[model samples]
Target: MIDSFETDEDIVVVTEFVDKQLYALINSEGPMPEELVRQITCDLVSALFYLHSNRVLHRDLKPQNILIDALGKAKLCDFGFARHMGRGTMLLTSIKGTPLYMAPELIKESPYDHNADLWSLGCIVYELLVGVPPFKTSNFASQDCISFLQGLLQKDPRERLTWPDLIYHPFLKGDVLVQQDLAASLPPLTEPLSDSQQLFKETQRQILLDRQPRGSKLTKFVDYFKQKISLEEGNVKTVDGEPMQISPSTTPTPDNPANSNSQRVHTSKSREKKKSKSFEPKSQTEESESDEENQVQNYEWLDYLHRSMEEVFNHDLSCVFKPPLVKVATSPLLKRNFSPQVYNSVACLLILPFITEDRNSTRLKTLLESYAESNVVDLLVQGMWTLLAKKKSELDEFDLVKSKQLSSERLLAIENIILLLSYLVYKQPYPKVDIFLNQFCNAVKSRGSSFALVTRHLLTLSKRRPKIVSDILSIYNHIIRILPSQSLVVLEAVIGNSATKAKEKKQIDLGKFLDSPNAMLRLNTCVLIRYLTRKFGASPYKYWDDSIKQKLVRNAKEDTDLKANVAAGLAVEVIKKLELITSA
Candidate 1:
């Protein structure tokens, strides 16, 4: 391999890529028959012994470096930092080498000799026979390169093992003669130390060519050191810093309008491109429109209702008895166009639920009685249909639908509705609150739009009224049947959030839905179960029987989504929790 090089720095090396490291091969294939390991160790010790005898110290040695060549012989290649020891000199003061394989003295930054390399050889031999390193720490406590070398290569020097002592040790004495013979056959080391000056110069030239501006001489010095220690290719560029590459093929001929067929072909191509650009995915548009329609309708109605209440209270407080602002200008509804009076009626219909709150029951009842007597309730129902018509017209204009700001507005509106419902439930009696709750649920279910937001509101109500948890779960069950996968993510978030609330009076029974064939739903359910168990100590498995646990384990094992990992983790946690509870 060394013979192909034009220069020492240009030497090329090659090795086979094996499927597994030596340690892994030994463990899984069951130890290369102890005798083979002994022979291999002997060959390796011979190589190290010869290299040291010739004043070459290989500071790094590990099983990974002991490559089995085409003939199944060990060949060591990496020697970017190998050093020489001559005459009586047995120490060198360079801090280098791999951490795990370095001797303790070297780790301590003490000057060391060929014996340091012998210690690393010991580590490799032990690993070969036992499938693990001898001095290796479980948590890698003593593996820091410098610290480990210091201990192995101890400053006292006497503590370090010599080649003769190591070869005869019980751990390495099994086949000594063959090892010594191999060690004795390596060529004598005698080449004068070639200054790495040429390598450094070539590296500097490459760096400058690559357009890498030399920030300081210190950076160049660091680059010089790196080049000397490794054979990695330097980033090179042209002297003028121009990007270098092979040129592209010739351009195509321009269209000739004089040729009528050519003109027609060009026009057709342009039209086709235009048509492709015009086509947008239908689902993306529909989802956006649905979100926007929800926002515009909810905001228009809620804002109107809130203003109507303020006007009513202002008139009552001032004793003005001003005629109620019965009508106002209105925009188109989600699916249809409606007049101002119809819009007011729609707003009034939604506000009726607010009137039945605990603090305002009497006033709300009186107001309802007056509206019934005056036919206001009927007019409001009519207005709702008109608002629906207006919404239909506006829907066409929302081309780039599902704006983030609109979704946020919808969330806020839903949160407000929940707050209003909570006030009603807290202050009103059961019959009245139940009546209003039915009205709220009807409005949500009727819209049949943005069911995720609706589910979230239902979830909040369920927390306050434990009986309502069943109702919300039923609605969620219906939602998962009709909603797309993306929409389901929203519902899952709401369900998971509610399941974790400490204030929830009833446990959310996710058992029925957890096994849904939909992978996303199953994943989401597992996520919720994991979160609940971790955060609230709610073991869904307890609520679910052993059959459910077995089913869950099977599903988790077979599920293809990344959620299987999460499920597996959760399974471990659940098992741990069960063990703890059972022991107690």
Candidate 2:
């Protein structure tokens, strides 16, 4: 198949247009052409040999997935379930593929290798040569085909003919060059879509919402229809007797003569207020004019921080496009096991625009209502804390990520949930003194967040739980640059100030902060290390074995961020001078 760069406009795969499928040719056209079958089988074997030699397995190998081009050449298509096995990897356990063409090992749910594809090829080849396939379920006696079928249709995968063996078959070894053009043999294909036609369809899709909203509702329901009926899943479809609605991302352009109001929904009547060129937010009470304000009323005000938060002199904090509206549902959604695709759609609409750390939330309640459902907060508080509190018997976060026991897809689901909770708790300050806040702080010390919703909250952990301390330090390092103001609070709490005891035991180790997949964390931790060194000096480094000290020093110097490198230079200089020890 042909390929293209990763742009948004990929509709269908661009491949060599084949006139007909091998299955259609066999069924519709009168009789099998032995010579043509030989050529097709060679092509099929060639594709499989390339795949198996590279330790790949095409789980599905039915005749319908094979296409015959007008050039009389065959090609394989539809590798939706293909997998790449590592060197010395013995078998795959996931049960998938068409049962009719499935190998004996697959049907028995036994672990099998790439040789499974060869068994399916035996079934197809037998059916192609003789009118019927020789199987336990159905068979027709054929003298010539029996030996070839016997060579491949093995109950044990170990006994199945490998690709190297199959290619040397007597049927394929014979030089039968009898003429048969597949294009002439099969019926003509339907006309292809013109460029103009393809463009028109895409334009229509992009310019308007789908014609049927219920169609999407049905699609959502169909995803879990079995559970919807049996388990009776609950869906939040309406608010105050009105249906949930999704809004168009962009409004109609100035050249369009039709009323913009008529063309699409405004989502909120407050949206009709004249937008400022500087994007200054309208007053919180501006929603008084909105008809639906009484039902879904929300108060919104801009809270700006200087853009100096980035580099201490970047610029002024800029605009708010409109009052942020947390889109609940324009259409219904399956709440259970939500996929990343649906999560991204929500992020684009409600979260991403306002994610800048420079903005502040005055009220956590108002923020949650504007962005997510009421239950999500409860789900966030309960579901996430449970995962965070999981005692690492032997597994760390990286171990969870690279788990061989669970599918990669399942690992993503767990991480997504944890990340969702982090977004929920984002921007809300960690209370310096509160019972409920203490509970949360303890969780942060255990396993805070694995996602990028940087929290402004700084936890002052006095308890000596090693896991919690490690995770809290990770969060502090991750978000130090994102929220420099709060980061200082963290440093003060952990590293101490001038009035503090000079010989306090180091509460948290900065070395565990390394090896984070988040590159920003590495740079930020190095900055914190520089700050810590100015307070504690070279004493910490001197006590450590050479490798630990070398690693800490190398990290600061080798950091990619220019600002971090500068910080490292200052840190290394202070440590070398042993100023704290000399002065004391």
Candidate 3:
């Protein structure tokens, strides 16, 4: 689509005009044929691979950002949210994107990578196939495309489809040779090959080379769990009508599992075990080699399971219920693997919060302990919690007025932290419930407007996830059970929040509840004011409007409920105590 470039004024690069946006095309053209959608998905993903390989991330990926020419060819446009993200660099914390197309990792405010684009790709594919994004529409039906769609929509990016997996999957591989041939023929046309198309063909060529057997192959992995792989050991399979090196012995008879009997190859340790029952002492070198082999096998097995989660079982809600799935989320030992750890740890935390049953909780806890040997739990908690603290501090320094107009990264970060904390408090409280709450309250103290926005965020969450919020709210309300001891910590936070809001002079719509007719509203409002007095003592007299202060004081003093009266009286005592201390 590139026409020419003008770098003189603002480096404006011109491109051929595309008559329509992808969103409009989908709406006007009805649902596309599944096969056609598959080809589109391939081209789009191939484009993404090129962009990602070049160290760029198209942060905002939605149907609106995609353009369709009269020939129905798609071009990814809009680089406003695009940024160059080098290898091992921190995940883009400066979030900017449409919400519906965002990956769950981004939604949870976890550090994410290029695979985030795959998640959005999944959304686009779903929209094309169903005329709406997955789960958003009841109009779509489940058919041949469901499995391919599920993998891309996976919440865990580590478990989501990667470039290699996308190219090899059945959907894109419907006629593998044909698709590759089509991909290859693009370069010869009068049109200059797009960066995306060229890069995609290049990837396919590299993949084809890698897939070729070298000198009859030395090692054959037993894909024991998922034998549906097209490749088979020692099997003679026709590849586009040409015989391959694979022999009849290694051919898979997956459809006839009962009749499929073959010699099971044993791993080194198993092979060693077959030799003798007696324990034989070995040299240190032998022991180290055995250990190394076992480690390699373990990692390979984990990788296989990661693929199986996406390919075989499919990433459904049921995946979250499986206890053993924690291994996918557990952080690796090496520090350089922190990005995966952050993603996995966040997944684990999100999973834990939703487990309400005792049996499920115990099952999940045991699985987590088994996977990471219980070492990473506290570390994971501390790491994510710390990132959240840092995000809040960053939000504090950014201009609130301008920041408000941008994406809500800070809002998502805080809500995720609170929900994770709430879950931790409910599920695994290694930091101790009271201690963790204190840390959270303290985190909120310096957060400035971030704290003020939390009330609004929670209100929004309450609407969207009422059942989940109801449960989370109970854990939060439990802080009141420890009242006057560490209970005032939350109250202090509320004071800080109200103070920040007052200073900003921005009125949240929800904040209007004070003057509402609802008794519950009036009671909660009065309760907040009572706590404000306790924090300020007599200082509210100076800082607050006289009319407002008097109204709050009178409400607390004259409220009919005895509980309300007592809360109101505490403010007076705080004032008297401050006066006595001053007189001394």
Candidate 4:
């Protein structure tokens, strides 16, 4: 031991000199004999025990930090990262130590303490046995050694071996007491092949390699798509040996306006031709010719577009539902201020285009534009409730100024949501409509009336606006159709627990829409009524007066829109049947 002082610019200390580092021995000799490792373990544990007894933490404990002198004794150095814990302190959250040897808790940026040093010591021990740290993924085949290492390398600090427990482990049962001095009993050190820093870097590299998931084997894009198309089309070939079929493209319907009409027509004609000839016997020339045509080269760009859409669909868009808690305008008709969560969700969406490579591809750009349109509608539907939270926070202080901006965010949000609900009820978005509905319904169920709140709010606002009646009724029609039983629950919530029949009757009056001039609104109202009667039988009839039933009968025969007439006709039948049953 020696006294030392710090200079103006640096801290310096004097200490007894050492002949070589322990890294020199491990680097050159590979694995030492069993007796020598046991002795080293005993010495290091004793040093750690003394350090812990004084409340000192040697945060960095690696082979490079331990020096061996002329007497062959191991010395723990590197006080740079050491800290003295106060008597009552529990854990340290600051990260310290080398990457290859840091404890899992430290790597995760979690709270940890003295046990971290023990993990580093375990790494050093593993390195001594296999010439590399255990995290580097080598198969060191000794079960006993592995078990001992597992005790120290536990990811959970609470379960890791502490000094008190390590002393009695099977590997160190009777070897806790250092029997002889290292000078007389340990193996001799050889010339070092590499410095400690270089070895540590190599260890770091190996650990990274071990922790990462292996990438899947690459497939040729052309070949893969070719095989996919072949399997999908039943390998139908044309007379000239061409691929005769591709994925059936959709036509622009009233529901999906972006669809391709010509492509759909071509696919329909192809299917009809195949069906008409399947039963007829073929001549010799006809038997020799194949029935399909190859168009893979022409549709390669389409395949790329499909891949991009799949990527967007698979992304976790649910983050939009987790809006930050910020005050929004209470009234459903007014514009609401933007919240931090909205910006975060917008950022998440903007990053989608860059998720796949070839950001410059025109097909990807078009696909993202299309996705953004539909996704905006979905985002409004799924997250509208979050924007409706009535909070009297700081934003309320500037109410007059904010109100004048006339932000139509909430109204637009409501409009798009109802439109989407109507589309889902009628058109059913192509490719995976059922899957989308299943997931959407599950999310709604878990949220517990979040969507219902938005729907009910729109219904209330429609009382004054009048233009949104069709939209609100369409939403109810969708809910009752898709979620028959859940719709009853949501409807009960919407109507609320009215103490008087007048209040309940005023909550939702189906007869008002039946007499409206708007045909779509009347149609949607009829559909809503029909579904309610079918599900609840005569229970909804109690809420309606004789005029409501009379209006239903009038619309059944005289409505201008045929679809509205059909819907009214159906509702009249349901009401009559349910009323008859009630009378019975």
Candidate 5:
């Protein structure tokens, strides 16, 4: 598929068009020519070889599932039943695939591997060559054809032709030329929407909304325009049974059309007074006038709403358009027994099929209303926190050798949920202090390693969404009292800030911070050393030598900033105590 996107009413998948299915070609021309069949068989075998070599099984491999282009090139389609046999996966017990093309082992509900697909390929090949499957009639055109059919149609899977031998079999040996892998030829399935593309998509959606039928509820501005025009023409009661409110000075006549919108703001303020007074059981004529006033106000409000929405949608969308670095074909929602409970939660599962983040909440809110059982606020915040914690854990446990592309995909998925959560939290009406965040902090305090992971993840996220920097600092500040050593990674940024003009290195030298001219940097460095002293005692001296300790002692006595002197003095005291203990 080229791209897939979800609308309020439908989910659309875009793909390249093919001429016809193999089933259609076979039905139209009784039996294909041997040469044509040879070309197609080569294509099928080449496709199967690539799949089986990669440990994938196209469980459903019939003629109807194959597509042919005008160039007579055959392509595999409909991987709805595809399965990947990962490392150590010996057999798949699920009974899948169409009955007619099922292997003998699959038919008997036995365990099978990628070889099951080979049996289905044999059935399709016989049908393509003879215009009917071999099992339907025993009659054979030639001895060689019979021999080829018998090798594949064996009752026992052990006797069936394996993928390696089938490709080199006499029927398709010379035909198996090196063919290009389908995936390598196609563009990426999904790409990040550039600024221009985001604007274009917004304009396209608005145009679609405008083209909807006038009376249909889908057309947001159409019916309102009709009502507004009718109200000005006939001086009738509005849609809500109120008489039209037209101020004499601002009213538009055929000759005075220019004055209509000039004093709209003045008229609205006057109408508000009239509306407030009308709330106290006014006469029928007065009530009608008030309702008509509300209709005009509603129309004006909608006009403003559309204008504001246009400004928001057309603004720089790059900050929000975070496409996954690694895209997976299927959503995690469809898979069972997946890790990181965040992916399986109600909020994450709901938005997995759509874009990472959307500013407009109409669709998301509609989905929440439909799919979410409990409170939307609770569901979203809880899921976001769970994902944040898992993200930290994944980063902390990174192993270059063991981490596959799925690990990258998992991080992207977690970020996708986070991006959506940020938008939702900013837009939705929820309490300022979320209970979920409090619970997360409490969990981190209980597990010191979790504090390291959480703080590291938040620090990484703050770089992307700068608005979350305060939250990161808040969590780091509060949690440090309970776990000091765990906050070492986050404090490294404090030391790194002092070395802005210097060449970057993998590890920042903490000693450099003590010699910096900036008093705040020197102060934070003292605090960091104090934390290290509290955590590792005199052990830090082994790595830094006595120069770092001398700098701290000098800062305690001669630093310009008094706070730095006090912090450095405290750090020195801790180091002295650690030194005495070590000597003893």
Candidate 6:
């Protein structure tokens, strides 16, 4: 027995090399003469009979496994999973066959004999006759194969036909039987007919022609078939059973200019007809209605886009300029106090280009230049500082004012604006960086409670532009000097924030505040110094000086409230920083 590996799961019995399979030949060239299908089916049945007589059950019989030699003789192969049955014993096990052609008994996992093979044969014959399988259903489990078996093959095994009886089944008993006899008596099945087929044959010929290597015999065969078909007269029938007419005036002839010209004209007309058939046009009234619907949808989308753009801009501006409480309280009289609406409008103006398609890049650049000239950065910075101061005053008098009027919302808005602007600056180099920095420095110096907000903005800026560290350090130094003793905690927070950078650690000198009379000042100074040491590999002793450390230790032991708490926290931070620095 010849053997060949078929797939990862099984092997196939090797047979004589065949040019093609009978199923593929029929499928590609359309339904063959019924006689040809019968002849092929007879050969398949004979092979199945022989295999069964030898005690081998072809459990997985399918069209692909049935090989057709060049002589048109069918052979059964691929018996990798075939089971052997001793005399008088039937093989009945798990269901295994192609789903569409499987026997009802097999699908139900019932004990079955060779009758299952006959059921599959009926399915194949039905497919050849109808160009599709019988009993097509979406629900595989619901398909009652028993009904098909009973009607097509007779339910009882004894009643079902043997191989001899199947060949004479009513469906295959007419003109097909005569044609089968003729095919069987003829010489070997020649290479499939080329001229008397559909356009698919011509396409296949062309593909095969192209795939052949240079100077191959297949090229000669392709040319021979192409010439024969090109010269043949039309005989095929249309679906309506009328003869398809080929106009002699438009017929293509080999190597004739007149024929070529006429052929092109005929092709062009055929294409025009096809185009007209596919083309569709709505009535004027219908078109007008569609246009109106589209216009409404477009307007809705535009409106939503505008609102989203406005929201993004407003959020960003709030970070730059949060309104002050004093200004909020006196707004009724002055009517000039900044509000969320005003900030939103200003932000929209800044980012309007992103939302508007009609606005050109040059026009946007001009708009940005105009805003830069008006010192918009300074206005935004001042607004943020004013808003922070108002929030602090309101917090101090929380009982006097209703909770709804709290400035946290305004503070958050201003923070958003600062972040937005910071992002814009990083993405694109704004020509007015100096103006923005000067205004930001002034704001940081004036509002002590706004240090956290200012520090965060500076942190973002530092990440974007490391070269601006000196400028940021200058602003930090100025803020530390002017901030009140009570606000030293804010200063300490800002200093601790700056300690994120290894280089910025040296810029802050916390030891200078060690001698301050305010216990909070000394406590914050120790905290900040310890943080810098840990973050930047700086020595805690160097940052606080030995005397300052002693003072902080003494304060932790004496003062019980804020001062002691701050000192104790600083002590822990100092040891952690020391360990990190030493490890580094």
Best-fitting candidate, scored by lDDT: 4
Rank by TM-score, descending? 2, 4, 3, 5, 1, 6
lDDT of 5 by residue, 1-584 (tens): 89999974457899999979999888988676666877797898778877766657788889899999989989998876686654333345446678889998887656566668778888887888788765567564456555666787787775777755676788775676544345553221112335775465455344333432122221232222222222232121222335433222333322333222121111234433542111111111111111322322323333433332333234322211222211121132322223332242222333332232242544544443332222333333343344443222332333211211123223434444444343332232233543333343444445444344333344333222322333233333323433444455344333232432233222344455565543434554566566656665544445466878888887787775555566678778878888898899
Q: In angstroms, how far off is 236's CA in candidate 4? A: 37
In model 5, where do residues sit more than 4 Å from their true spots?
1-14, 136-138, 178-584
C-alpha TM-scores of all predictions:
0.27, 0.36, 0.34, 0.34, 0.33, 0.26
Query: In candidate 3, what are the lDDT values of residues 1-584, reduced to their tens digit?
Result: 46656652334667787888989989898788787787677668666766765656787899998887777677788876776643223244334578999988778655466778888998999888878776855534345467777788888875876755566677776432212233442222212336876565455344433322121110111112112211221111121323333112344432332212121222236433653222222111111112222333333433433433333222233333443454344433222222222333333333332332233455445443342333333433344333323222333323222222212322333334444444434333333334444444444454544554443334333322232233233333344433345444444333333445564332322223222322223333344444445544554434444445444455455544433334335544554565587678
Model 6 weakest lDDT span, ten residues long: 278-287
Those runs of model 3 whose alpha carbons end farther than 4 Å from true positions after fitting are: 1-76, 79-396, 399-417, 423-477, 485-488, 497-584
The local lDDT score (0 to 100) that residue 180 gets in candidate 3 is 27
Steric overlap count per candidate: 35, 5, 5, 7, 2, 13
Query: On a 0 to 100 scale, what is the lDDT of residue 525 in model 5?
Result: 55
Worst 10 residues of 4 by lDDT: 283-292
- In TM-score terms, which candidate is top? 2
Q: Which stretches of candidate 4 lie over 4 Å from their true place?
A: 1-379, 391-409, 424-433, 449-453, 463-467, 493-505
Note the Cα lDDT for every prediction shown: 0.40, 0.42, 0.45, 0.51, 0.49, 0.42
- lDDT-better candidate, 4 vs 5: 4
lDDT of 3: 0.45
Model 2's number of clashes is: 5
lDDT of 6 by residue, 412-525 (tens): 334334532432322222653544444444544565543544443333322222212222332332233222232343344344344345444444444333433333234434
Report the C-alpha lDDT of model 2 over 1-584, residue by residue, as the tens digit: 58535433234567667778877877876346666667777787777766665556787888788888888778788776776654323445455677878998778656566778888888887667664554454444344455557777888875766645565667667432222234442211111225774465344333222211112222222222212211121111111323212122233221322221122112234533633131222111111112222211111110011111221122222222212222132111223223222222222222222332223444433444443333343333333322222222222333222112222222222334333433333333344322222333444444433221112111211111222233344344333433344444454445444543444324334443333322333334454565445445553444334543455466555644443344445556656566456767
- The residue-level lDDT of candidate 6 at 15 comes to 48
Error of 2 at 538 (Å): 54
